[model samples]
Target: MTATVTEQVFRLPDLGEGLTEAEILQWRVNVGDFVTVDQVVVEVETAKAAVDVPIPMAGKVVRLYGEPGTSVAVGAPLIAVAVPDERYREEERAGSGNVLVGYGTGGGGGRSRRRARVRQRQDEQPAASGPGKAASSSKSDPLLGPVSALEGGVSGAVVPSVSTSRLAGTPQAGEAAKPAETAGGKASGPGRKTAAKRMGEVPRVISPLVRRLAEEHGVDLTLVTPTGPRGVVLRRDVEAAIAASRNAETAQPEVAPAAAAPSHESAEAERVPLVGVRRAIAEKLSRSRREIPDATTWVDVDATALVELKESINRACPDARIGMLALLARICVVGLRRFPELNAYVDVERQEIVRLPHINLGFAAQTDRGLVVPVVHDAHRLTLAELAARLRELTADARDGKLTPQQLTGGTFTLNNYGVFGVDGSTPIINHPEAAMLGVGRIADRPWGYEGEVRLRKVTQLSFTFDHRVCDGGVAGGFLRFVADCVERPEVLITHL
Candidate 1:
């Protein structure tokens, strides 16, 4: 079964919490492209949304799996990154306890650092800002943001703050210098090569599985030469070393074949793969229908006064942008406070209703990617302006595909303004694990009976869906009526405000 990599070389991220896979949406960084640590390598879509995935190493990408729209499972190898240099791979593997050379933090006190005295001429000293610190030529490495290193220079000196040292081996005072050290940190002279050979260092192995195989077979890695790109030890090399040790003379070195292609049976249909957030959504919705006895209740309300109040407030404070959604959010916050039972989930195993003390209000916002719910933490604590501002920020981030995982989950109750779609009402499914979801339909002009006569009024439909196991229509109806009254008479929110 092992074609190359011996099996499971490098794998995709483990999306814990029962999620087993992600579908590749697109590649942000291509093969042969150099990437820094934490650089976004790909944009992967889970059922929840499209999330930008970052690679955790500084290297040139050697390999990546599949084209866009490919579905990969957890623990599957997504890409193989060939690290930049031997020292980088070693330092990264051995852990940063022994600080790796050639890396500099930024400059200090507006002053550059003193360069290391490694093989530099006596008169070629750099200019010093004060008495102690010498000037440095520095540029930040993408691997570490704001992490400026000495240009062409590798330092062993401990300096304070960021490094603003001159480039390694760069002649500061216009003098000809010896051949600079190679990217492998090897000096030019024969004597330096001898010294490097004497030094003890760990062998460069990217895959943990490779190291494990070598250890299991009793093969010494230092004795085996590397064959992978950029001096990385591949699994085949280790296997070759093992064969040589066992047979000694009769065994020949074997090169591993490429990973086997999928059999014709693996070819799937045109249907969408059920995984990540999408699979999770399906399971949750299905479970909600199966486990929780749910019901929907609707009401029509006269929102003419709420609209008039919104206009008056907008005119009064032109600087503050308080939207209708924010007003509704505030109303929901108060309504939930009045009827707190709706702000809870079912503890299935314990057979109990878990009422949350704080509220994380999730509101639906549609973007080019798809519809998403961005949650507002502690919605009970935000003012109308604050709520509107947060909503604007989250919605903007959603549109730009920059929402964090935390912002997408942990919603206590949902506020769905389906009204934007030009619809009247919907039997909105409750966000699972959430006890309820409040849906607001389009508010339009309609004939209504006022105090003494028929008049044109702004009317909208409100639909409240809840878990019947948590409460009957009594509590659900009460919460709906409270929100409706608040919408009709905006002044009534003063007591809660």
Candidate 2:
């Protein structure tokens, strides 16, 4: 008699970086399509790059939870697969190893009898003899002697033994393993059974190229073991091995020719699909520009005194390490306090303007992933030293892709310092719902007539944009002038407070 098949749901794996979310770019396999283990099932665009997720088991896809363009959180079910026999289900519940799914590992089901036999056979075979038996023997033989060393001491490398335990285990070492007992020491569900069976079939071996390269480069492959399929050394594993060896060499390093040469054959422009944070930023900016009847007013201010102030403050408090951006943020906070109207947000749903008592100043930081606006919450409450420290923390988090949703939200006003890029000035779009945005331009030494005498002074441009319905040109201009006045004579800011 034939056994009945059961369907199990497969979830999206944590793509490392502790990223809890990702956007689905496309699905390679659809419902009812037969997929084998390690076959690419879907393409996902991570914050870092486009990556293909491999199917964990050989089965027919029964269902898909999301479509292209949909954003999904980690651990959310992505696909469903049907497996033959309740026996497979039973094995999954046995607390067996985990199966590789996409870029991560999932709880495994029971191992199949046939798979167990194959593994037994392979394990029984002598490690010294295999397809590359002659080569292995020759390399291992001490009589053959050591190979010639390269300029940097890179010589004959040996293929490292792969460690299946690491790949099957958690990404980090020393973490507590999940308990086998699932509600009274029985298998929690059928999904675990399927996961166990799949993991049992995965083969562990280092890639041939990685092994050869390791030997050629005199890299200790053992130091860079594979974390994929059994103990297969992946390309990344080999590269890491090489890097480790190079770092161990000398205090001062010599550059390698391979490192200097560009790897890509063509200088093709890489096209990035607009989605996630980039998409959200574009949509918000577009809506703000279209609906906010924005008008920008600029002011040229002598920032020479402000530069001197920053230098003196840095000397007094070496640990604080304050910067121009922090000073500008402080000035913006003071100006917002004076012109409380600019610190208000438009409540379109309620058809009313909501004024905020506390300042949440958003700083636009450019990251390799995209532009991120990390807000400095309760900016008004923070001192200059505290504000600088907070800004530094937020900037570092943003670049590292570690900022939380709260850090990216709830901004009454945004400050884009185009001066960092050496740009003079440009009109910046307002952050949606917020009434205004402030743009800081490059600070340069320019000739200015002060009391009928020409003198070189550090000058910068300030541009402010506000929603016309909430703020008229006069109000916007006054706000910009106030900021310029504070920056030009920064001492006035402290006195106003």
Candidate 3:
């Protein structure tokens, strides 16, 4: 039976937990290409992980809403599918069943399914300034849009421009500009409008994320030049303003930057927007540096025993293969049990050191996407064999970029094995909120005192970085020493068993 055809528009469904937006990585199905139910139509990268999204209905893709690298907000139009089935529901509200980790197709596919109203304030009619030159009104902040510079050597949105000084009644330096009075004796003119704009006027911002970003960085939206069409300010505009301000502040006196040298070279450079995983890494690492006062301590350890033990175990049962990282993870679990202070995070608001009931161990894994730390929840509950299997599965998933938000978050402690890169040791930043992290260096045969004689033995360095607000040097040193001791003599772990 031939069913009737219908054009259906599908919005990007909810990406997953804690992720509000995703950058379109690639479109699996192109326009005019037929797709099937539960078929992957696009791949998107969020801050946490990358996952493929599937369409709910079988149809020919009539239109793909966003292009690759476009940051599509949830509930925004993603694609228009022309399907033969009249019974198919709108893919925006209800997509095919589970498509990715943490989130999937369902009612209200996107968080904000209500499309943002695209408003266009009259195609900016800026007042002219000089002869034979296009000029822009500095005070005409229509929809918080951008205004290009006027003639006679002007740059970015600067205060007291020709238009603003002429029509806006520009005040003198250090003088508070009072609102100009009109014929009716009411506070009128560009000055009053600018003041009122700051007070309130329902800013025509389409995304709340933009507003939040500005607030976080203490950026004044008015001062930033809007580069989007029709004077609309985009995120890139704000970011550029931020970079300019930073450079101005850091610039040295008596030595101006190249831009100051009035050259014919345009003051533009290629810039890649920090979006998706890269953005997440920047924010998180910056937070860790800003908030956590961490200290690192490292020690050389003899790993000959641990190495031999792993080889013995693997040889005894090849089917139950174990890895050195899993072994280190086991040691961490045991150490946390002995000293539970390291297995918790600080609550800043309550001024409390909240200890967690379970240990969710996060291990660092580098992938083509980026460095992701996939967590193994409830590590304390898993047996050594189970732990090994779980770690193997997680490492594979992380390398594959298939980890979900649930698997990437909720980590109480972190194990960073930097040795895979053949490095000796590193003072890695403690993953934020988590109290401490243990880093393992490369294990190599080194000369060590064995029975009062120098002998070449397997050795490695263990570095531990912990939040200073947590337990002091005593507890941190004790934890590191214990791990080193266990690594040197694997039999000592039997005591805890």
| Per-prediction CA RMSD (Å) | 17.9, 18.5, 13.2
* Residue ranges of candidate 3 with Cα displaced over 4 Å: 1-10, 16-18, 30-38, 55-63, 80-276
Ranking by TM-score: 3, 1, 2
Report backbone clashes per prediction.
Answer: 16, 16, 3
- Cα error, residue 488 of model 3, in Å, equals 1.5
- Given candidate 2, what's the lDDT at residue 36? 60
- lDDT, model 2: 0.65
Model 2, 1-497: lDDT tens digits are 44455555567776643255565666798655676656778777555334567755555565555445445566766666666645434544443333323333233332322222222233323423333222211112121122111111111111225343332232223333341223354334434323433444222333334445667777654455555433444555666766666555533444598777545443334334354567667777788877788878888889998999999999999999999999999988988888888899778788898889889999999988888888999999998999999999999987877665557777899999989999888888888878888998899999987768999999888888888878777778877888888888887887977
Q: What C-alpha lDDT do the candidate models reach, one value each?
A: 0.65, 0.65, 0.69
Residue range 1-497, candidate 1, lDDT tens digits:
21111111235665433445566666787544676655677787666666666655555454455445445666565655544345344435644221212112110121112222322322134322222334353444343223223222212111123121221223455444433233466454534323423453334322443555777878776666767543445566877887667665444455456754543433322323343455566787787787777799999999999998888888998766878898999999999999999999999999899999999999988877566788999999988888889988998998887775567878899999999999999998888889999999999999999998999999999999999988999999999998988998988886667
Quote the positional error of residue 96 for candidate 1 in Å: 12
Sort by lDDT, top down from the best: 3, 1, 2
Q: CA shift at 51, candidate 2, in angstroms?
A: 17
Q: For each candidate, what TM-score against the reference?
A: 0.58, 0.52, 0.62
Cα displacement (Å) at residue 58, model 1: 2.7
| Model 2 residue 177 lDDT score | 34
Candidate 2 lDDT at 368 equals 83
